[model samples]
Target chain A: MIKFSKQQLKIPQMSKPVYLVTGGMSKFDRAIPEKRTEELVIDAFLEAAEFIKKSPEELKEYIHSCYYGHFADHFGDQLLGEAVIHDRLGLDPLGNVGIKTGGATGGSTIWEAYKAVASGYSDTALAMGWERMDEVPTDEGNHYIASAADKDWETPMGHIYTGYYAVMAQKYWQVFGKEEESFRRTLAEIAVKNKGYARMNPHAQSPMKITVEDVLNSPIVADPLRALDCCLMSVGASCVILADEKTAYELTDNPLLLYTSAGSHTLRVADRRDMDIPLLPNESPDQYKDLGVRFPGGDRYPGFTGFLAARMAAYYAYGMAGIVDPTEDLDLVELHDAFTISDIQSYEDIGIRPYGEGRTYVESGDCYHTNPFTGQPGKLPANLSGGLIGCMHAVGATGIMQVIEVAQHIWGRWSEMHADEAKWKRFNRVKPDDWTDLQVKGAKRGLAISHAGVGSHVTATVLVHPDHQLKGRG
Target chain B: MTTQNRGTVKVENGRYRVTGNFHYAYPNDPIRDESGKLLGITNPADMTHIHAYGGEAPFFENLSNAKLLGTKCANPKCETYGSIYIPYRIHCPDCLMRNEEVDLTELARKGASVHTFMITERTGAFNTLEKPIRFVNVEFEGVSTILMGYLSIGEPEIGMKVVPIFQTKNPTFTIMDLSWVPAGTSVEDLPEGFAF
Candidate 1:
């Protein structure tokens, strides 16, 4: 069995605190034929400046350094894309670096910027991420994405990334789900819920008022995973400004305290060796001793059914943010719903539910904006911005968008940002007539999980209003 | 247009001796909306990439010989000394030491079982596999990790026993050269160019 040294499991301690001053996102769509990528990026930046009641030039002055996240240069046919964006943003003279970690590119960018601000290297920093997946045809785009897998081993077999996830879904279905018909419908409910929530999101793509039956009947891309159960291939830009305490207060009176942590595992799932399940703060050591007995072939810690990277990321984040039980300590969360099964997998990985019981999180309606059972606010609402399923999976921009979505709720501005008719009209999208306001009232703290292909990379970003900051924050 | 003179490479004098054309260029096409509004241009091109397998070269080379090559960690001082890996890891993940290659053909033939599987009708660009591809993750006895491969014949079910098949005839020298089928699949039922 694999083991971790004490040094490897140490909670990350920052020399100084970092805060998120402001963030923004551009209109997301399957394709944006009207504007270039740079124009979309500029639009997102202008929105960030306007949110803080400052001019673009005024906000630009606070950025001491920049971190740009743009995955797959081949997709855009442009190398040094970050340099091009940096030049266009007029932050040329400052030190800047490019970050790419497949699907976790956006969160990795924020992690870098948070470190820069925390280390006193920069008083303020800009973490910007974007993706342009529309340049290539859908099949060719899938090829580009599958390139993220091991080039020699995994990529050659059908060159489809979904098939890789499909294998894991099959294992999870049999072992944890017991291949139950009710379990299959429970997975469908996540799609229905996320898409239904998307109707209220102006910047979302693929907003459908679909039912669980519609999801069950949609064309199956891979067995047990229908087309609607998958995430959208989108084009958009998102960005956040992180700063030290003095600079943050100088920029905005109310800035959320931010803590970002990252973890990684073997790039190829085939190489993941068996190990003991790393316990989260909320778990007991012997809580999973009978896992293999309970679910045959489930003894393997992460064997096709779990994302160890997400678990490690949450393990570190919970310690750093003093989050003992996510269900009780956090107000809301935005998880990477790359696929419906992977979404369920993440619920267990991030400690929302114990292993083999992720279906309960959705079935019990605890993940909804308003729990259907009690007609009250969900104990912990999840993916209210529709996540990657109903929203956009714009690769480099996705994690940043999730963090911004969570921050909006805590800022009590989710309705202001999502309900404005003028903003929806500017993007040429019709506001849904039943656009229910989904603002989680009195939200004080939240989290966002950014995950990469399979379980290679994951990052957890926790944000807390200063007044509601939990104790033991580093 | 099939190009008979695609690029090929060989090592000579400690350097790559490349031959023939490696890239093909095509004219760009305009992309427009229904109103004929200019949107973008499509740049079409084809190119070949020469990739070296390095230390993992033996695994691919052995596939056509009807042999399965895996690696075992040989460092006794390491935490996972005797752990064996398929998909051929060149180094022990725990100790960063070179792994000793081991033949797993007999073991896989006798003991490999399907851990999980999927059948996908969709594939990405440049895929050569047949439609409705059945993908399986096969786990062998005593092996710490499972290996992913396509099933050459029959539907896959969890816990179903399977045996390895290799593209011994006109092999592509890729991971595609290796496949799996039901344990009792006869030689006549094998796919073209493949054998047990």
Candidate 2:
């Protein structure tokens, strides 16, 4: 499987273009004991309907089929949870399916809905996702997450998913990072930035104005990765509605063009085989010839350092969207910052920066909303919704929430949605006195990367304004 | 208090023969808020699962005997012929043909080295390993992939040579029976119930 066939590398071409009409998210937190899962799901759907100026009953009329994403059914002690939600939402008699791809479940659910609209099976479709990780204790929740790994080979080792994932972070820390003190601080800076961004997001689970030293001083889950470096294990719901061009305008005046592509690797990192690096349009074969000379042990393609799945997903997505380079082509990104180190790795995987040089994205002040060095807007701000690190990692709802965050900027409604005092009061969260608008000015295109455990499955979702889409798309 | 007899299973004539209790049920408890308002109930149960490894059973069965087993794609017509896998593949991924089981005990003993390692002091429920589990992804000289296991003794560093040790005595018949240690360690210093 290392070598690709010509057919396998073909760029996906939809019969017709699909557009994201509107999307919404509920208040995300570590636990919501006062309400059942159905209530949170209804809250998300009601917001989406409200955004488009439609009633819940009116929105349900356009949904021909349903796709629900709910990871770890065992955690909720409910089998067929999707059906329960579908019935509660009053969408029955129409075709519906469930998706479970670990952390990427939310994106994969949208991927299915997008294809349904593209293939002419349905003019409009509903993609809803949610998770209830609070039903069980933290230790039991960790065991449920680890079950996503190979149960026999990996789960028996420690029954903790973080230990299985930390090996890659350790390798990246040593080889590319060179175990430098400054490099460790750069990793901590991501936590500080994401948590700071979370303070402005009322739905965010963890929000704190902290320094890099605070992150370094946090408890060590594993060597080189502190407690703050990890993402939150949250509970919440989020959803999006996809439609064709004709139906999109009917639903909303502004609809962003949407494209989704996915890729996967072996469940166990132990099974990864050495392969030649798949070059993106921005890279050349000669560009990485001396990677080993620059950083020893860095020549290995995806050798516990790079996520081949993310790279492959980006490969197809960029091709489909007619993107040659991400940083220059896209306005911003919402990367899956499951861990600070993994966030750096993804910057390289998606071609924001070349391999072994992801640290530059953060240090050069390009990843910030406002460049700390230049005192101007950052070239490409990342994770403005606080990402998994600060916002929430409610498994099934995470990816959908990331895409909705990006679309708000494209719709020129980021301020309208986020700056509402009613929303803060509704969620019962106190609005900060110094809340700043994080809307990327003149945003035309953006991307969100949804990833699963240890690079097992990854999906790339690219949303561009129909007026700004690139010509000669693959 | 009841003396619980855990469930056990055996395959006889292609059918499962079960003995003792396979599941136990507990009374559901009401979960209420401080105001004594009803919200939900807790459901508790314990159960056992029967899993068959199928084609890869040989790899686990030989671990208790202090043997490391791997698989090789011997298909001459395939694109990737003679590729060795430590996490033994049931069949060649490139070709659907069955793979030949090859003993990798000697190869692992002579040339295994640590590619990457991590130490974690936290574990989830049902974890049996000691706190601060030292995980090492070991690379063999002629293997196509790396194998993940724990270091039984000493700290781990990249490119450090290590040798395999098995819990030949009172084996658990799981992946836990196999471990790794610094290559030149003396036999007397091995962990309890383990041998090189």
Candidate 3:
């Protein structure tokens, strides 16, 4: 191990010369019209504009450039998507780009946007994606995802997507010994939570909240996982606003100032020879100590396939924020609970509880169905915004929605948060120690986790809450 | 001797022909494992053969003689799961889970039933199984979807009992050695035993 002095261990906090704030989306997927590519991006750009009460002239002046992410079957359109979208916004574009990152096109898009703001390329840039994938037939879609697989070795061996996830799920069951009942109950809780969120969201395909028994009886997708566990194929668009600290104040009366943003992407899974060195998310187990995860021995106690990726991401975010003792500090998280299992693992991986204590945390009424930290009644909070599960996902826009949830939570739009049958319970409050850790000690650093693939990633971003008392430059 | 490789991704330089060894499912529609991997099927079970020279992966030679069937864990880590994986891994690359040639109890082929299925209107193998052909995901109690073949019967439903029935490609594709049927059935309801 490379041991360093305590003074040398400190990581430099990056400074942004310009701010790119607010990420926006125009629905991840819908029965989008087969129109010219320009029309689709224009619609998504307008949809993003709707989130903020921005005027054409004022919006044009603050907006610097745009980055568009898309994955079309063929090189259908070669024009700059940013230019096309910006032209509709009628802005003097300083920077405009378009990229494709396979299934992760959306998350990669936001990461690119964050880089632009950090690089001082444009003061306030827009990163957006629009894909109407229903056009690709299911078989053709299968072919597309398989295109990324090792064509000769893996594909010929009949290693398809579900097979890979099934192998992991089965292995998780073998390791955790957390029987089907445990997986079932966790999934039910996630489904109910997301459906509740969808009630407030008109765009969600399944807006009605369902019961645990309802999911238990549903058709099984794979052996253990049922239909309810999968995300729907829905059509929608969304966007999140990212701006500089000063511009954040000007963007809205309440602005979620992004404190630190770091993300990593892996083109292939098997290339990494060693388990210790995870290529993506670029963080290690030691880093978790900084992210406020009170892991004993500074090592991740392994359990669950989906949680590992997220844990790595959280560890990096923790390093950026210098957060320790995460279980007590952070309050209110909006993670990519892509599947029911993903939600369960986040509970343990994010240091809410020790590893293997995830199942017990749920039973003790901690993670979902009730706010564990605050014990707010009628709150089945996690993915209240229907998440990707209830909201359905089109890949690229899911991360933007995750950013929106954190913003909405800090904004006190309780309805926007996932709380079912939850009447505003003003009676309960955070325990004194917990309260200090959250409101004062860790309030400046709120953590958010996002994942990709089936248990493939974890992106934890620590958003430092801006305080009026702080003398830092606005 | 050296060519700065431009497009040399493909490795199968040997032209190992598989002519007339085409595998068919759903009467003709080929069955592919999820992730859209085509599960290799031989039209007639007899036509199915493997030629691994100086290779590994323990083939259960006297598998028919002994009630137990087994395969070596080319992937040792995969050994814990009873080698249940179709196209079983030699050393389980998935979990890094290790295992050797562990003893495995063969599944009771008699009580096999359709777990879940889709009467495909159209899919990858639409030509093989027609728009209305049944492609049920079946599990023989103790096994996975490792078993895939023709179950010539009525409508494929949940828990519909099917014996180890096989078809032929010109030549009769039949499980001649192990002609099995439902555990308990009336004489009138007996299946016609066929061997290719």
Candidate 4:
């Protein structure tokens, strides 16, 4: 029993900061038929613990709580996932909860663990995300993924996840003048580039070197989105260890301050009226009366507001981290690139460029290893780990994998056995003698963005190197 | 080629049959029902729906009668914002207050406009026909919620006027029982009391 204070409490001047000391992820593959979800989680956890130079005993004693992120329990033929994982790992009697936010499960789990540490509820917490997608067949797996959408309307109407994105792509083409040839070319470039990057990442599931022509030749699953445009359904697990500033310092010399934020919209895509309407209501219809189109209605196409939730989340994260210009300030980014078009959308959503200019940004070759715009080496490389497109998309693990990639960039740990030398050379252009060149040189700040279920829920996290100078902070 | 005597083998009909203790890797087994039947749910009937909460009972009941119903938020502030929910939300999401049931039968007659639409070529449980299936997001008149249904007649165009086409024969008493067709298109076996 606890006694409650009736008096008003004063808020603290500064909240405790949370840091990610180390992170680990299993190799993303199509199907690890023999490995169970619990086994995969344990493997990732051990690797994360090893990264912090901690022994098994130390890890068992240090972690105060655990948060597991899993999607589609039926896919794995398991329930009470967190409890099973905890018991299997012999971390019982500790606080644990399972989080499900579709594809953003990993990011949401990290956010929950960050809160646990920031609020002084726990000093150290483990965030693990895993999914066993290979247990089911392709069509069944698709059905499981589509379950994230509105079952009452979207699912019953035969709106598969890919079909929904296809519709959005179609609408985008209709409204934004179908530069079909150029638009398709740009999309192909994205697929080719990401896949090309994946060829260097040993952990990536699809590391085959592909070209723009290869992408164009691929069969169209959904119109405008070819087979190469989508990510492979992968089975894998990832873990990130979050601790208070003190614990993080004790764990590792290099620590990354994690600032995470999330935003949600209607679950159903049709409910996203923002896609066709202005952000701010048009109260002054007379102001635009002279315009040919209806003043109040404004433009029927507002350029696909599906990524608005992600934008909102990123805005909150940037505000917290005091980052105004993300494209210039952040050294690198790891975004959810489940689909090639999704990567293009993330560029605008994460403020790399203004709305309706994602095509221009990609075409400029800014997202590549060497930017044509600035001519700077490794200028704002997005998805250095092959992303979900080149890398495999393990739904639950993808968000955590993004965070891990950013952490590796910040810590200068790109030469870790998994980094492919040839692929690295292709991306960076110059020959590298050591691990330093494989990383974003002098990178102090990075961002990781993730979303779930047709961009209905989004999470954006800004990570800063502990020693980096931050504005308005001593 | 010379035969290896080290490995155990038996010959039958000029073909060598390996009889050694060889390890064979088997793929993960599929889930089966209690009766040992492969429960591969390809059709929609293989799935089950359990409506534990009765909040949506009225909405489904109204659908069977060729009528549409919505819930109006009871809170004054919510009502001021013109908040009404289809599928009949029992409580207002914004105000966190109970909502009053509202009959939207007349609004259904007026029909809705296609807000957005998609033409899918792939076959699925709902899109069973070989031809393309046009799914539309229809926004009803004066209703905030957008309803999703298939376009039964004509092509799907943005802002195209469409009306609900309820199944008068053997209604499923589910949302599936209702679809949408181009406005003014004759619908056979409509409910006697309805004026659509």
lDDT of 4 by residue, A105-137 (tens): 888988889889988999999899988788666
**Ranking of predictions according to DockQ:** 2, 1, 4, 3
- Candidate 1 error regions (>4 Å): B1-4
What TM-score would every model get versus the actual structure? 0.99, 0.99, 0.59, 0.81
List, residue by residue over B155-183, the lDDT tens digit for candidate 4: 88767888886665666666666777788
Model 3 lDDT, residue A130, Cα: 52
Candidate 3 lDDT over A99-210, as tens digits, reads 5654445555666666666676656767666555564446544444444544322232222343333433443443442455765686576777676656554344455558
* Candidate 3 true-interface contact recovery: 0.02
Q: List per-prediction Cα lDDT, in the order shown.
A: 0.93, 0.94, 0.46, 0.71
- DockQ of candidate 2 is 0.88
How many pairs in model 2 have backbone atoms within 3 A of each other, for residues 3 or more apart or on separate chains, i.e. clashes? 0
The predicted structure with the larger lDDT, 1 or 2, is 2
**Better structure of 2 and 3 per DockQ:** 2
lDDT of 1 by residue, A360-472 (tens): 99988889999999999998999999999998998899999999999999999999999999998998899987889999999999999999999899999999999998886
Considering every candidate listed, which one attains the maximal DockQ?
2
Clashing pairs in 2: none
For the record, the alpha-carbon RMSD of candidate 4 to the native fold, in angstroms, is: 12.1
TM-score order, best first, reads 2, 1, 4, 3
lDDT tens digits, residue span A74-130, model 2? 999999999999999999888999999999999899999999999999999999999
lDDT of 3 by residue, B59-84 (tens): 22322333323234354433234434
lDDT value, candidate 2, whole model: 0.94
- Per-residue lDDT of model 1, residues B126-175, tens digit only: 78899899999999999999899999899999999999999999998889
DockQ of each: 0.78, 0.88, 0.04, 0.14
TM-score of 1: 0.99
